[model samples]
Target: MSTEKPRPTFQMDGHDVPFDEGQSILAAALAAGRYVPYLCYHPEFQPHGSCKVCTVKINGRTHASCTTPAHEGDVVESNVDELNDMRKGLVQFLFTEGNHFCPSCEASGNCTLQAVGYDLGMTSAHYSPLFPDRPLDASHPEVLLDFNRCILCELCVRASALVDKKSVFSLAGRGIQKHLVVNAESGKLADTELSVDDKAMSVCPVGVILRKRRGFQVPIGERKYDEHPIREVAVQKQKGE
Candidate 1:
């Protein structure tokens, strides 16, 4: 007799969906072609659950979809009004927390933060911008670090240590004071073994970490987010990769 257990399924917006054991709600949803917006979740990296952008109503309770494990018959309410509004508020908070002036930002069209704001229909920051006088680091020959644009996502940190095998970045300080720091005695990225083509350089989802000589290279009308929205790009990236 054949011996194979039927795959478990969950109900995301009342639609049956299959998921592997221990798979997160966001993972399964993306695998099933249902895009749930997220920031701190990437296909190649472990879930950090920091952004809370993927918050969904799981079985009548709020949970971060990127880290919350999926189970059979779990009812996940992602597109509901309450959750979408909450995610929108989070997007606004992120906007105000950084100096994300999209008009002149190099990462404007391709940035996940700007893209997420677009996805959420965010027309304004809705609050005063912090406008903190953060420093910019062009110490590296082919890379730049603009602290003003950082949203503390830590994708660079994970890519540096986990993928590139170099501990180049970290989060230091508590709430309202947290910041991304370079791990070097000289507090400079040029002093590290960080190449321009390092995995960390490509993993940033914001304008903070950027490559030199490529600013506006793709042009505004033909950027990644310009063609396909972040939801589609993010979901396709997870499944296609």
Candidate 2:
């Protein structure tokens, strides 16, 4: 068999991006320093577009950057007031659907969902709270599952499926009653293949799926929020640069 590697493709914002065989639009954009807001999409895991916060204008239509493929001559617009407003509205819906009390959350200062809310100027919840009563799963020794704080973004689900290759998490029910469930028979995370090293816990944007023994390990002023805007971080990570 041949051992040759493939070359990378390049594209500009105004020009249609020439996506190589397997490159995603998000990857191409960030490789070129283009800022695209995203959650539920980590380079380490497969893209899950459940967040709907990464919507961008591509050739005049809104498309989720995580799943959209780059094409030659496609005019991609990442920053638009209307698109930002849509993202803020979507995040607002997420906030109302769960108990995202920032002050009491272990992820408060370092949460990607919260950071994205702040970046999108979602300071208040305009929708009514769903207030679904959810049980906290603390059976696992390394992670905690507080379903109340979950936005159903599916980051954990994707990470568990794609990265861990075990598919340990999933959403059950629908609409207001939709909730995250563990793969184990007891519905607890304790006996699953999941562990502290699993990206499922770390990739969650809210306080829902959390590390049991590692909250506040970095201190208030030392977390990623203290270093740079999440948009910059997202771009950097997606580009792998």
Off by over 4 Å in 2: 1-21, 239-241
Tens digit of lDDT per residue, candidate 1, span 69-167? 999999889988888888889989988987887888898888888888889888888989888878898898988899988888899999999989998
* Model 2 lDDT per residue over 190-234, tens place: 879897777776778778878777777877767776688787876
**Model 2, position 238: C-alpha lDDT score:** 56
Candidate 1 at 111: error in angstroms?
1.0
lDDT of 1: 0.89
Measured by TM-score, the strongest candidate is 1
lDDT of each: 0.89, 0.77
Q: What are the runs in model 1 whose C-alpha is more than 4 Å off?
A: 1-5
Models, CA RMSD each: 2.0, 3.6
TM-score of each: 0.95, 0.86
RMSD in Å for model 2: 3.6
